[model samples]
Target: MVSIGYFLSCEEFGPRELVKQARLAEEAGFERLWISDHFHPWNDEQGNSPFVWSVIGALSEVTSLPITTAVTCPTMRIHPAVIAQAAATAAVQCDGRFTLGVGSGEALNEHILGDRWPPALVRLDMLREAVEVIRKLHTGRVVTHHGRHYTVEDARIYTLPEQPVPIYVSGFGPASTKLAGEIGDGYCTVMPDEELVRTFHQSGGADKPVQAGMKVCWAPTEQAGVDTAARLWPNELLPGQLAQLLPRPRDFAQASSLVGRDAVAKQIACGPNPQRHLAAAQQYLDAGIDELYVQQVGPEQEAFFTAWSKAVLPELR
Candidate 1:
């Protein structure tokens, strides 16, 4: 059976609310957790981006559900060595229930440091090296390295879990998917593409866990759910590399303006229909996902949790 987890959107909630949601998710019977790591909200409308590590620390105190970063970009904005320390601390706090999910990041988050966002291939290479640096530091031994994309000088993580934190690499395409298979302890993505999952398995990730995240909007009415989703997460509908290429919340907003409500309604599971949500999740299960993380978009948190616990999650199980 595929594990069903709740996805906490840092872009839409503050640290305290995220912690509260983690507790609620546990009560709702979700088996695990996935939280987004971002420096900025995709648009001003989404309105928040708390430092993810701090939120994870709070989550550890509040819920026992295993947590994984939906994806953090360690190649830029933050060095891999620093990420290694933070992830180590998080793993200790979660009692070894934490996973560090990494990826070749989007310019919206990585470009905030005024660094030039490298091309896709270069970014993938950097990610490979970054993961190497992180793995070295997680050994709890002194590590020093000079690599093409990063340099670590006598760094070591002191506060670590009894075991090394499992690192899950995120991939949206073939090259990165293959790299995740080659180097990652597991694999993560946002889509339900069966071919991508197959590529990961064939490349080297067979028997490794594969996780995917999807969004739904649960409101009293279908149209209301569509409106809420379109207003808050239209970026989900933006095609191609736009999500990766856009550098600012406003840029995302400008680009997202082209996304219409009809598109979002068709793509995302909306409203009170349990079958719609189930069908959405079934796609990921059909694609052979080991874990499926679901995010309820907009502000109907209580309604969403209540409905999913009673209607959706039990049925999925």
Candidate 2:
């Protein structure tokens, strides 16, 4: 079955908001949930960044749906050993409904450690090492690692679930996508470009669950929805494919403001029509992804959910 899901926005909601959303999502018949792990909201105007791990912990108590950090960078700011431990505790708390989704990370989230952000190539290497480290520690046995990007000796996770948490790796372009296929239990991305999925499977990601996401704003008019998405997610248009670069959230917000609404609208789907919303989601399903997590961008969450559940979901099902 194609798993349908939603992305919990840490950028606009606090812990209380997340808990309410998680409950509503499960009650709405969504199967999975992904939450953004960020120390900073992309923009001050966007306003909200509750510590994600804490939010996830509360989610364990409130919902039955599985949850994952849509993508967290274990190699920077936080050590992979710490992530392994956190994942273990989270897995136990959630009753096996947790997945550790990882990525190379960006300056917007991971650059606060005062270290110069590495290039994408180096970040990929670091990501591999981080994954390896987390995997080994998840076994609940002591591990020692001395890799090109990480150094850990005698680390272990004591409170692990009976089964190790699955790790899903996120990628933006071909290189990281292939790396995710080769190293991850699954591949995750924002764009539903099937070619990227093909590249991953060709590189040995066969049977790996593919997950992709999109943002939408349900409104009375197409332009109204587009305008809301642009206002909240203008960062999508920041030049130079920033998913690979940029080290600070402040920088992200600043760069995003430099772009215009028309430019931001080109990347996201925003419309008043249910057909357009369904079409936007179809792009991900057609890409061979195993899951589609939609982020409802405007204040019309209940309406968006009602429309999607009534109009789009049966077709996907």
Candidate 3:
């Protein structure tokens, strides 16, 4: 049976609210938890982006659910060494219930440091080197690396898990799938596109765990859900392009406003029934996603979780 989880948006809630959500998720029987590691929120209206590592520590104290970075882009904004240290600490904090999810980040977040963002190909190369760097350090060995992306000497994770923390790679396309297969202990993605899983396996991620996420707005009726989704996720309507790729949440919001929310509603599944939610997840599941994470938009989070836990998840469960 496939495990299910939720996307805790650090960009949306306060620390107290976040802890409450974690407790609620655990109480609701979510098997695992995933969080966004963003530096900003898509809109000022959205209002937050707490440091995810700190939040993870909080989550550990509040629930027994395993935590994983739904996706953390380490190849650009932060050096792999920093990620290794953070991951090690998180692993320790969670008492071995943490997995590090990583990827090649976007300019929106990385460019804050005044560095030009590399093209996708170059980003992939940098990611490969970053992964190598993280892996070596995880060995508890003092590593000195002169690689394409980083340079370090005698670096080691003095406090690490009895078992090495698993590294999960996030990928949207074929080349990345291959990269994940080659280096990731598992894979994480936003869609459960099975072909992507096949691509992942072919690339080198054989027998790895897969994770996917979707958005929903649970209401007594479908129209309310649709309206809520339109307002919040108007970004879904933008033509598939780089704006969708910008790392800054404000950039994403700006792009969404330009594209308009009504247009995005056409693409999102803000439906009245379990079937629509199931359909929403099926595409990603078919894509070989091993875990499906759901994020509910609008204010009825408790109701949304109840409905999904009772109706939609049964089929997958």
State which candidate has the highest lDDT.
1
Error of 1 at 143 (Å): 0.8
lDDT of 3 by residue, 1-317 (tens): 67888878776776777778778777777788888887766666667878888889888898888888977888767889999989988999898999999888666567777788788889889988998898899899999999877998988789888778899998878888789889999988776577888888888777778888777777777778777776666665556446325767677777777765455455566755888888877777766677877777767878877777788777767
Q: For model 2, state the Cα shift of residue 251 in Å.
A: 2.9
- Once fitted onto the true fold, the runs of candidate 3 whose alpha carbons sit more than 4 angstroms away are 243-248, 258-263
Residues 126-237, candidate 2, lDDT per residue (tens digit)? 9998999999998888898888878889887789999999999998889999999899989889887989999989988988889887888877778988888887888866
Residue runs of model 2 more than 4 Å from their true location after superposition = none
- Which lDDT value does model 2 have at 124? 92
lDDT of each: 0.94, 0.85, 0.79
Number of backbone-clashing residue pairs for each candidate, in the order shown: 0, 4, 9
Supply the global lDDT for candidate 1. Answer: 0.94
lDDT of 3 at 301: 78
Worst 10 residues of 1 by lDDT: 151-160
Error of 3 at 122 (Å): 0.9
Clashes of 2: 4
For model 2 the TM-score comes to 0.95
Q: TM-score for each prediction?
A: 0.99, 0.95, 0.93
Candidates sorted by TM-score, descending order?
1, 2, 3
Query: Model 2's lDDT to the true fold?
Result: 0.85
